[model samples]
Target: MKGEHILPLSQSGSARNTHIEDHLDGSSAAIKVIVFGGLDGILTMFAVVSGCAGAAISPLQTICVTLGTLLASAFSMAYGEFISCKAERDYVESERLREEREVEEKPEMEKKEMLDIYTNRYKFSSADAHDLVELTFRNKDFFLRHMMAEELGILLTEDDMTPVKKGLVMFGSFCILGSFPLIGFIGNFLGESGSDTSRIIGFTTTALFSVIGAMSLGYFKGSYMRQRRMISALMMALNGVVVGFISYLSGLVLMTLFPEASI
Candidate 1:
């Protein structure tokens, strides 16, 4: 059955690394979701910490806000990814079942539809379409498999952990990445006596992380090293600017609210 073939492809991999590679290459949508989610979390937390520092808030306050934001963002992102992936899986499954029914009840019509799909996709002539259809339909099951794999590109069965696993990975990765800047803040603040030194350390750490992430993503996508470096630097700089602006605004509000505070 088509389901048998499809199921193998879906589950073909070592359990340990399948999810990791899948998130990297399964669908562009999944990759983008994870990348952007991490980027946003990092930027958001960086800005919050910077703002607190700007407002002259104590190290303790900064740590509290950064940790709070990290936790909240991670949970929200994870849950959102879970729901979205589940919906996609459900839609794919529903379509597979519909295709299965069509194959059972209207074999000839389904064959014609499959031919048309391939014909339009590959731009084949009428004679070629008929020839191709005949060749594909030699085994009834083969024809259905071709239609499912080529025309629909949806599988009959999938890993139970697909969406939930992906969500957890994305959220956890983001939280970990985001915490870098905050950790920098804590280290600088606790280790150094001067606020200025701490702020510099925090900003440098944030920028470094952004550059590294961008370069990694670009390299994985097979872009030129020089171009990727430039792109990464630009993205990091842009992130810094946006976060800096937010932090400035937040600092203003914080300072107004806490007149007794050093800020």
Candidate 2:
């Protein structure tokens, strides 16, 4: 213990603050939804376009099909996000209320639990632990918060986004980022119709745009996660390419199996 060099309390607090700031800076529910949701959007649209191209569908038909899938999927993702987040928030709220009830009905037991946590987990001396517990229990709200964190491992923060806001973010991310792959086909369909070369060009452009979008999302995610941005970007792009290729092959097989439906 002589050379352990334990940090002073103030310095330890500052270090914890710095760590929290670094981790929380770009890491929010909305940002997470945007990065991951956008990746989902781009890859899904890319796969859809690849499938249509492999099936030799008309450019106009491809545009229509992709739009249909994009809108439907976005709506589904948004609604699902809303319901799940709402459920989780509700659960946390319920647990907080339950903890408050326990604190009110069983004050001695709650105090004993807090004392045990401080003395056993934090290695506080018995007198210091008792003093800390008594001080904490003086404020009912603060005591409840402490119990929630130490016992339930839940930190209820007002800064958290509402379920509705997160859901809206998800919907927008899915729609806007997901539109990358469909843009090329729409433009090609409007300008030049019914040509093999134009179809090939459209497919090429779609794939390019989708990869860019996926890489951008990955880079943003990497920045927040403190990882190598280029590596993350490349990995995400690779995943999209691999999945899109498989989807394209599946489409080709479907087309082959039902040549009559190709018309």
Q: Point to the candidate with the largest lDDT.
A: 2
Give the Å error, residue 169, model 2: 1.1
For residue 137, model 1's alpha carbon misses the true position, in angstroms, by: 2.6
TM-score of each: 0.68, 0.84
Q: At residue 93, what lDDT does model 2 achieve?
A: 74
Write the residue-wise lDDT of candidate 1 on 6-112 in tens digits.
Answer: 33344334324866545533454445555666676767776776677668666777788789889988888888888877777767667667877888898789878
lDDT for each residue of candidate 2 in 1-263, tens digit (9 for 90 to 100): 01111122333343347667556733466787888678889999999999988898887788888999999999999999889877777777788778889999999999999999999999999999999999999999889877777777665554446678878999999999999887776777777757888888888888888888888888988887779999999999999899789988988999999999985
Q: Residue 165 CA error for candidate 2 (Å)?
A: 1.3
**What pairs collide in candidate 1?**
none
Candidate 2: worst-modelled 10 consecutive residues by lDDT? 1-10
